[model samples]
Target: DVKRGKWEAPELLKEAKSFINKHKDSNTKIGKLRYMAVEDKASGTGLIQSISKQTTLPIRAIQRSTDKLSRTMDVILYVEERRVWLPANAPWLLNYIEEIEGLTADWTHDHDDQWDPTIDAINDSLAKKPTVFD
Candidate 1:
């Protein structure tokens, strides 16, 4: 919780690893993203609170940019919603990051040249703003 925004992404990743090492147990993973059911969609109070408390990230920051920060770190315990879920068997959403590029999805396709963002179809889908559902 000390050096969140202030620290570099790699440092934050280390923090995430430390957090995950402490939290994850049998039948439960800490770093992986999960679908969460919330009480309300408009305010997003419960969901935000849960994520904030668990991730040690401020709600405002999470609200502003969720994926960017999350992709780098490994031990983020925050909960996203079903809205973020891609189509059935979304091979693109395999992972949240890459070493060469900035924050980007981990595509499952073997033929893909990840460096070519133009061919990455996942970006098109992600370009659409996330819809809040109840």
Candidate 2:
């Protein structure tokens, strides 16, 4: 896990590599058509470059315009309507659900990082057209 302190580029790169390797099969399945989006600022720039050079995973740099709450709220309807689905018996299932439940509009929590990409993916899907991924 990434600690809440200063991080060097090398450290971040190593962590990214570990994460990518850990999910190698899924990454391969995701393929070149789908991108792994990263914020287009600060360390994210380096991360995109590093991941692109070191792994086969495609990377898309995203420039976030809206605040966290607004971004998350955009997908709230999907969640409420039970359109969002989680893995049936994943090990982290309970923790993931707890994080979703813990989210507040007031930005009073620490799970935003974990949930941001999920919301982004859902919004991106809904924006284009409703689709399911295995």
Error of 2 at 24 (Å): 3.6
Task: Give the poorly placed runs of model 2, Cα more than 4 Å off.
Answer: 1-7, 26-34, 129-134
Compared with the true structure, model 1 gives a TM-score of 0.20
Q: What is the C-alpha lDDT of each candidate?
A: 0.35, 0.72
State which candidate has the highest lDDT.
2
Residue pairs in collision within model 1: none
Model 1 ranges with Cα > 4 A deviation: 1-5, 26-61, 65-134
What does candidate 1's lDDT look like per residue over 3-95, in tens digits? 122234455445544554454442242243222222233344544454555654333312223333343232222112222333344454443
| Cα distance off (Å), candidate 1, residue 49 | 22
